[model samples]
Structure formats: C-alpha cells, structure tokens
Target: MSSVLITGASKGIGRAIAIELAGRGHRVIATARRPETLADLPVDQRLRLDVTDQESVDAAIREAGEIDVVVSNAGESVRAPLESVPLDEVARLFELNTLGALRVVQGVLPAMRERGSGRLVFVSSIQGRMVLPMIGPYGATKWALEALAETLAIETGHFGIQVSLVQPGAVSSGGGERAKVHLKDNDPYSALYQELPVLRGEVVTPEAVAATVADTIEQPEPPLRIPAGAPAKQVLEARKVAPEDKPFLAVPLNW
Candidate 1:
C-alpha cells in the first residue's frame, strides 16, 4: 500500500478518510493545525500542519517522509453576498481554501517528481460547479481550486504526478453550521439566506465522501474530477444539460 498524507484530518471528511485508508492498511499520515486533536485516530502518524504557513507544511512533509499520495483536504466555508462581504474575509478565505492547497502541493511535489509517481487529491465541493446566492464566496474558492487542479493535471502528467478533485455536495458537517454566515438580522440578503437551504440536495455522511476518495485513489488512472455523491452528480448533470446560449438566470431553478 502507498503512504498517504491527509490535511484537515482532525474532523469531518478528512477524519473519515484517515480512518478508512488506515483500515485498508495504507500508511496514513494525518495532519492538522493542532496535532493534539488527532490523538484518537488510528493512523500511522499525526503531525501539526498549518497549510496557511509554508514552514509548517514543509515540516510536515519532512516528517512524513516520501508520501505516495497527498490529499489536500484542508478548507472552510463562508456565507455572504458579494456586495456586503468584507474584502479582508474574502482574502482570508482564499488564503486557506486556495493558496493553502498550493503550498502543500508545492511542498510534496519535488519528491514525487524525482520518484516519478504520486497523486494529489483535492476535496472540492459541488459549489465549484454551480453557485447559490449566499454561497458565492465559498463557490468562488472551489471554482478557483478546480482550475488549478485541472491545470496541474496537464502540467504534471509527464512527471508521473496525478491530480484529482473530489467534489461532494451537501455534507453533514454539523448541519451546515460549519459555514459562518456574515450577515446581520436586518441584512438586505436575508431572503437569500432563508431560501438557500431549500436548494440543497440530500446530505451525505462524511464516511460516504471518504469512500469516494479512497476509491479514486485505488484507481490506476483516476479521472481528473469526480462528483462524489448523488447530489454532486446531479449538479454536474444539470450543468451539462444546460443550454449554451441561455443565461444561467434563464434556466429553471428546479435544482
């Protein structure tokens, strides 16, 4: 089995993946901003890794030693309208959800390049495919992440490095409470906030998402992008069937 490294593994999908992969006998190195949070996991190694900090990322990679697969799952969610969202908050979101993945990718890539084999799996969201009113900020991050992962797939193919984006729909991440809403009681976008949850599909467990990621890793030649749940697949299918000339606004809001 390959040596695997997962970020944001203290809880949620990352935590489930660590458990699943370890159960399958892969050497699992699970890391988070606080290594102490990972004490109960059955993985091979638990190290402190803050993806926002370059030094911390490098240190984790050094300690892990020759990782064969890197699952860049460290990310967060936010809810706000573009008109009222703070610029500083947007920047912080990008720093974690976007650049953080890049830092980890850059850190582990050299060894993979020299050894001529590795995999990079990024945990993206269905929002990357479609956008909701109050979720634009979060969608923006995943959309940008998809672009980077797609580009890396082309650029790193010859080096024997594979990149995949695992996009899951609504997850049971504490009833979506993980996403901090930036709006106030009398906010102008209150209507959107009230209606947002209605547009979501069935909520899947973290274990289901973990199963998809693990299945993707087992593929000798996995596809560049995978929609992990029924909700995720439905979103992608909707996008595919949409008319090219008509605006997204014109399309039915049946989703």
Candidate 2:
C-alpha cells in the first residue's frame, strides 16, 4: 500500500477522498487546520496543517515521511462579480486555492524526485476552463491552478512522477452552503444574480469525486485531466464548439 497525504481532509471532497483511499488499504495521512476535526477519520495519521502557511506545510511534510502520493485538495471559493468582489477576499482565495497548492507541491516534490516515483493529484474545478457569472474570482484561481498542474506534469514526467487534475462540476459539498456572495442592492448584475440558481444543475456527490481520485491513483497511466461528472463533461464539450460570443448555459432548460 502506498503512503498518501491529503490536505484539507477534514471535510467535503477532501474528507471523502481520505476515507476512500484508507478503505482501499492505503496508509492515508489526513491534514486540516484543526487536527481534532480529523480524530474519528479512518486514517493512519492526522496532522494540523494550514496550507496557506508555509511553515505549517513544511512541518507537516517533515513529520509525514516519504509520501508516495500527494493530493492537493485544499481550496476555497468566493462568489461575487469581478468588479464588486473585494480585492482582499480575492487575494485570500488565491492564497489558499493557488499558492497553497504550490506550497504543498514544493514541500513534497524533493522527496518524490529523489525516490523517482510519486503521483500528484490536484482537485480543480470545471470553472478552471469555463467561467460563469459571479464565480470569476474563484474561476481565476482554478485557471491558474490548471496551468500550474499541466506545467508540473510536463516538468516532472522525466523524474518518474505523474500529475493528474480532477475537475468536478457543482459538487454537493458544503462549499455552496458556506459560500460568501457579495452583491449590493442595486448591483448592475442583479438580473444575472437572480438567474444564478437556474444556472446550477444536478450536483455531484463528494463520494463520487473521491472515487474518481482513487481510480486516478490506481491507474498505471492516468490521463492528465478527468472531468468528474456529466455536467462537467457536457460543459467542457460545449466550450469546444460554442462561439466566443455565445457562452454555454449550465441550465439544461436553456441548453
């Protein structure tokens, strides 16, 4: 069994992935900001790790020696227009979603390169490729992440390390429930905001996403990117054929 380390494993997709891998007999090391939250998880180890902090990442990596697989699943989302979203909040999102993943990669790559065998899995979103209303800030981070993951795959292939990106559509994770939507009463995008609910289609479950991640790990040669659900796959296909001026709508009725 391979030793796997997953960041942000206390809840949502991260938590589900940890559980799935552990059930598959892998030695899973789960990390979250609060280790207590991971106390009951069926993992080999639970460490306090705040991906936004470099020191925390370094300490966690040092403690968990020789990881065979690293799942960069720590990320956050902000729902707001690019014009109205606070710069500070956008910065915070980038810090956690983009830079945080980079930090973890840096912390784990040295050992992986030395061993000449490892796998890096990044949990990105479909928004990484196609942007929607009110999710621009969050989408921008994923876009950057996709670029980073793809480049990392190219750079690390020679070192016997594989990189994979799992992009999921509107998953039924607590992220939607906890999302911070910012909009003034007379916002110009009010109509679009009203239509937002209709834009969201069937939600994929976290367990399903977890299964995809596990499958990716088990593959001797996994694809560079895997869209986790029907919604994601359909939207991505639409993006390829849809004109630049005519954006594809997520709502099935509109499609």
Candidate 3:
C-alpha cells in the first residue's frame, strides 16, 4: 500500500479522503494547518501543514517520512465578479489555492524523485474547465492548479510519478462555497451574480470525491484527469457543446 500524505485533511473532502484511504489499508498521513483539527481523524499519522507556509510544509514532510502519494487537496475559494473582487482577496486565494499546492509539491518532489515513484492527486474543480461570472477568482485558482499538475505529469512521468486532477462540481459539503465578497455594495455586476447558476446538477458528497482520489492513488497508472461526479462530467461536456462560449477553452488555465 502507498503511504499517502494529504493536505487540509481536517475536514470536508480532505477529511473524508483520509478516512477512506486509511480504511482501505493505505498508510494515511493526514495534515491540516492546525494539527488539533486532525485529532479525530482515523489515520496513520496527523501533522500540521499550512500549504502556504514553507516551514510548516517542510516540518510535516520530514515528520511524515517516505511519502508515496501526495494529495494536494487544501484550497479556498472566493465568490465575486472579477471586476468587483478585491485584489487582496484574489492574492490570498492564489496564495492558498495555487502557490500553497505548489509549495507542498516542491517539498515532496525530491524525495519522490529519489525513490523514483509517486502519485499526485489534486482536488481540483469542474470550474477548472469552464468559468462562471461570479466564480472568476475561484475558477482561476483551479485552472492554475490544473496547469501545474499537468506539467508535472509530463515532467515526472519518466521518473514514475503519476499526476491526476480530480475535478468535482458543487461538492455537497459546501467545501467550495464561499460568501460573496465585493469591494462595495453598489457593485455593477450584482445582477450578474444573482442570475448566474454556479451549482448545477447533483451535488457530490465528500466521500465520492474521496473515493475518486483513492482510486487514483491505488491505480497502477491512473489517467491524467478524473471527474469526481456527474456534474463535473457534465461540465466537460457542456464546454464541448459551447466552445464559442469559452473561445480559448484550450487545455490550459483555472479559478
């Protein structure tokens, strides 16, 4: 069984994934920004890991020992029109959702490389494939993560490191839901936010996303991308049907 290290495993999808993997007999090292939050998790190890902090990540990596799989599941989202969203909020979102994932990846890659085998499962979103008006920043972060994970797939393939992006839509536990943040009350895009439908189809459970990730980790050679629920599958199809809706809807980018 692979020794799996998960970021943000204290609750929601990350928490569920840790439990599922541990139950399946993998040695699971569950981590969160606050180790205390991890006290209730049934896993092989619990450690403090703030993906946005290099020192915290380093400490966790060293403490966890040899890690065969790194699930970069720690992320936060902000809801707002791109124009009205505060720049500082955007920066913080990227710092955690984008750079935070990168920080963990960088911390673990050398060890995985030395061992010549590893798996990276990123808990991305269906929004990574398409954009909605109110979810610009959140989608941006996921899109960025998708790019980084894909690049790692290519760069690390020869070394036997597998990368899979598990894109789930509208997770049921409200994992990705965020309070709308605008710089002012008289925002121009208020109507747009009110009208746009962000959550479509059936909401996925944290366990469902966790199962998909567990599959990715356990597979001898998992696919480069996976949709964690029907909604996400629909999102991809929706994009294909309306390419003009997203002209540069090429194989790169995120929220």
Candidate 4:
C-alpha cells in the first residue's frame, strides 16, 4: 500500500479521505492546523500543519517520511461578490486556498522527483470552472489552483509524477458553516445572496469525495481531472458544451 499524506484532515473531505485511505490499508499521514483535532483519527500519523506557512509544510513533509502520494486538500472559502468582498479577506482566501496548496506541493515535489514516481492530487472544485453569485472570491482561488495544478502536471510528467485534480460540487461539508459571507444590509446583491443557498440545492457527501480520492490513488494511470460527484459531472459537462456566458444553465439548478 502507498504511504499517503493529506492536509486539512481535521474535518470534512480531508478527514473523510484520511479514514478511507487508512481503511484500504494505505499508510496515511493526516495533518491539520491543530494536531489535537486529529488525535482520534485512525491514521499512521497526525501532524500540525498550516499550509500557508512554508516552515510548517516542510517540517510536516520531513516528518511524514517517504510520501507516495500528497493530497493538497487544505483550503477555505469566502462568499461575496467581487466588488463587495473585503480585499483583505479575498487576499487571505487566495493565500490559503491557492498558495497554500502550492506550498505543500513545493515541499514534496523534490523527493517525488528524485524517486521518479509519485502522485500529487489536488482537491479543487467545480466552481473552479463555473462561477455563481457570492462565490467569486472562492471560485477565483480555485481557478488559480486549477491552473497551477495543470501546469504542474505538465512540468512533472517527465519525472513519472502523476497529478490529478479532484473537483467536487457543493460538498456536504462544514464549508458552509465556515464560509465568510460578505453581505451588507443595503448591498445590491442581497436578494441574490439570500437565494444562493437555495440555488445550490443538494450537496454530495464528503465520503463520496473521499472514495474518489482513494480510487484515484489506486489507478496506475488516473485521469488528469475527475469530477467527484454527480453534480460536478453535470456542471463540468455542461461547461464543455454550453455557451460561455451561460454555460450549464440548462442543466437544472438542482445540483
């Protein structure tokens, strides 16, 4: 079994993935900002890692030992229109979601390249491809992450390192509870903001996403990108054929 290291493993998708991989006999190293939060997980190791901090990332990588796979799942989201979102919050979102993933990648790539065999799985989102009201800030970070992951895929192919991007749609995680909403009392998009959750409809379970991650790791040659949930598949497929301006509008908003 492969030795897998996952970030943001205290809860949600990351936590689910850690549990799934461990159950499948993979040696899993789960890291969260607070190591105490991961104390109960049945994984090989629990580490305190804040991806935004390079020193923390490097130390965790070193401690984890030879990682066969690295899942860059540490991320956060903000709900706000581009114009209305606080600049500082937006910056923080980008720092955590976009650059944070990169930090982990930077820490692990050297050893992976030296071994000439490894997997780098990035947990992105369908929002990386399609944007909706109040999701601009979060979507922007995902978009940037997609670009970075895709570029890394190309650059690292020669080293026998595989890169996979796992995109899920409206996951039933605590993301909503943690999201920073920026809605002013008199904001023009107040109505839209109120309608956003309704429009999101049903969400996929975190276990579904974790299963996909495990499957990806098991594959000798997994796809470069995978839409982890049904909603993600529908949205991504629509984005491919639908008009650029209103892609996936016809796919029904139940997703």
Candidate 5:
C-alpha cells in the first residue's frame, strides 16, 4: 500500500479523501489544524499542521519521512469585489490557497524525487480557469496553483513522479458553508447583479469529489485537469471550444 499525506483532513473534501484512501489500505497521514477532529478515521498518527506556518509544514514533512503521495488539500475562501476586499483578507486567501500548497509540495518533493516514484494531487477549482465576479481573488490563486502544478509535472515527470490537478467544480465544505453565511452580508456590487439565484445551488457533495479523486489515483494516466461535477464538466468542456466573445459564469448564482 502506498503511504499518503493529505492536508486539511479535519473536514470536507480533505476528510473524505483521507477516509477513501485509508479504506483502500493506504496508510494515510492526515493533517489538519485540529487533529482531534479526525478521530473517525484510522488516526494513530494524526498530525497538527497549519499550512500557512512554514515550521509546522516542515515538521509534518519530517514526520512523514517516505511519502508516496501528497495531496495539497488545504484552502480558504474570500468573497468580495477585488477593490473592496481588505488587503489582509486578500493576502490570507493567497497565503492559504496558494503558498500553503506550494510549501507542502516543496516539503514532499525531495522524498518523492528520491523514491523516483510518487503522485501529487492538487485540489483546485473550476473557478481557477474562468472568472465571473466577487471571486477574482480566489480564482487568481487557483490559476496560480494550476501554473505551479503544470510546471511541477514537467519538472518531476522524469523522476517518475506524476503531478496531477483535480478541479472539483464545487464541493460542499466548511469553507463553502461559511461563504454561504457571509454571502448575505451585502457586499459592494450586490444590488447590481441580484437576478441570479439558481447559481446558488451549484454545489456537489464532498463524497462526489472524493470518488473522482480515488479514480484518478487508480488510473494509469490521469489528465492534468479533472472537472468534478456536472456544472464544472459543462463549463470546462464549453470553455474548451468556446468562442472568444462568449462569457462563462464562474461565481455563485447569488453573486
């Protein structure tokens, strides 16, 4: 069985991935801010890892000496227009979504390179590719992650390490729930585009995304991008051959 390490495993997609992988007999090293929350899984070696902290990331890597797969699953969400967003919130979003994942990758790559056989999965989003409104910053970070994952795949392919990106269109998670709560706070451009309520229901359960991830992990040659839901699949396919003038919706319907 391959040894796997997944971040943000305390809840949501991260948690489901951990359970799925473990159920398949892979020895999983699950990391979360609150390790105790992972009590439901095989947790003899649960880890406390806040992705934003370099020291915590480094220590977690050190603890998981010979990893076969590393899933960069930690992230946060911030909903607001680009200009109206506070500087700190924007920074936090990137720090958690982009930099945190990068740090984890850097920490694990050395061992993967040494082993000459490893898999790296990035849990990105559909918003990474196309943009709507009130989600530019979030999408920007995912876009950056896409670039990073692609380059890493090329750089690490010769070493027998496979780098892949899994774009879950919209998985219902703690962060999403939190965003829903905040969505009604009345942001800058709320009144201007308030005719979209159907967009609000565009979310798939974490279990759905986890199933695709498990499939990708078992596939012989997984693609660089795997859209996770019907909406994401449609958007990705449409955008693939879409006309330049056509616009694709990337934000929630309520936004």
Candidate 6:
C-alpha cells in the first residue's frame, strides 16, 4: 500500500480525499491547521500543519516520512475585484495557495527523488487558466501553481516523480457559503462581481472532487492536468481549443 499525505484535511475537499484514500487502504496522513479538527478522519495520522509556517511544513513532512503521494490541497481566497483587493490579503492568498504548496513539494520531493518514484498533485482551479475581474488575485496564484506543477513535471520526470494539477470548477464546501473575508475600498471591481452570477443550485461536492483525486493519484501515468468537475472540464477544453472564450468570467451568477 502506498503512503499518501494530504495537507488541509480539516474539512472540505481535503477531508473527503483523506477519508476516501484511507478507505482504499492507503496509509493516509492528513494535516490541517488544527489536528483536533481532523480527529474523526479515518486516516493513519492527523497532523497540525499551518501551511504558512515553514517550521510546521518541515516538521510535518519529516514526521510523515516516505510518502508515495503528496497532495497540496490547502487554499484560501478573498473575493474582491482587482481594485478592491488589499495588498496584505493578496499576499496571504499567495502564501496559502501557491507558496504553501511549493514549500510542501520542496520538503517531500527530495525523498521521492531518492526513492525514484512518487506523485505530487496540486489542487488548482479553472481560474488558473482564465481571468475573472474580482478573482484576479486568486486566479493569479493558481496560474502560478500551474506553472510550477508543469515545470516540476518536466524536471522530475527523469527522477520518476510525477506531478499533476487538479483544476476543479467551483465546489460547494458548504463552509464556503459562510466564509467571509475582508475586501478594501480601493477594490473597484465590485461592478464585475455584481454582474457575475452565483451557482445557487449546481455546485460540485467535495466528495466528488475527492473521488476524482483518488483516481488520478492511482493512475500509473496521470496526465499533467485533470479537470475534477464538468465545469472544470468544459473550461479546460475551451482554454485548450478556443483561447478566446470567456464564459467562465460570468460564473459568479452561475456557470
């Protein structure tokens, strides 16, 4: 059985993935900001990991040791237009969504390279490929993730390390509906956000994304990019075939 380590497993997609992988017989190591929050996860271990902290990341990886699959699933987003986004909030988003994953990959990759076999999966978003006005900061971070994952896949191929990017369309974590982050005065993209529709009825569940993640990880040669939802698939297809399409920009109201 392969050992799989997931970051941000306290709840949502990360929690679902942890549960599914554990059920599949993999030795699952789940980490979150608070270990107690993940006490109910059916995994081999639940760890306390604040992805923004270097020490926390280092300790978690050292403790998990010899992981066959590393899934970077931690992320946070502040919803606001480019003009309204606060500089500090933007930095924090990058710290969690992009750099946090990069740090985890850096910590785990050496061991994987030495073992000559491993998989690294990054949870990105459809926004990574397309730009939306208020979500520019969040989308910027995912774009960075895509760049990093693609580069790692090319660089680590000879070392028998596989890197894959999982781009999911909007997912309903339930908690997301209640998540409120601050936006600033300068963030003028409010009009754009107001124009976009919200998906009140059709949102992909965390469980669905988790199952897709499990399948992707188990593949012997997973592709560089895996779309985890129908919306994600559609956006990815459009990005690949028709670079000019911008339908996803109006996804705020409904995609």
Q: Candidate 3: which pairs clash?
A: 138-255, 139-254, 139-255, 140-254, 140-255, 141-255, 142-255, 143-253, 143-254, 143-255
Error of 3 at 184 (Å): 3.3
lDDT of 3 by residue, 1-255 (tens): 989999989889999999999999999999998889999888989999999889999999999999999999998877777766789989998999999999999998998898898888899988787765667898899999999999999999888889999998877666545445564677776666555443344677999999999988888879988989777887787677874743533233233
Clashing pairs in 1: none
The runs of at least 3 residues in candidate 5 whose Cα sits more than 4 Å from the true structure, single-residue gaps closed, are 180-188, 192-197, 245-247, 250-255
On a 0 to 1 TM-score scale, where does candidate 3 land against the true structure? Answer: 0.92
> Of the candidates shown, which would achieve the greatest lDDT relative to the real structure?
2
TM-score of each: 0.95, 0.95, 0.92, 0.96, 0.90, 0.90
Off by over 4 Å in 3: 176-180, 196-199, 245-255
Query: How does model 3 fare in lDDT?
Result: 0.84
- With candidate 6 superimposed using the best TM-score fit, by how many Å does residue 40's alpha carbon deviate from the native? 0.6
Q: Could you tell me which residue pairs clash in candidate 2?
A: none
Q: How well is each residue in 206-227 modelled by candidate 5, as lDDT tens digits? A: 8888877778888878888888
lDDT of 2 by residue, 86-109 (tens): 999999999999999999999999
Worst 10 residues of 2 by lDDT: 246-255
Clashes of each: 0, 0, 10, 0, 1, 11
Which ranges of candidate 6 are over 4 A from the true structure? Answer: 178-189, 198-202, 243-255
Query: lDDT for every model?
Result: 0.88, 0.90, 0.84, 0.89, 0.80, 0.82
The lDDT of model 6 is 0.82
Residue 45 miss distance in model 2 (angstroms):
0.5
Candidate 5 displacement at residue 172 in angstroms: 2.0
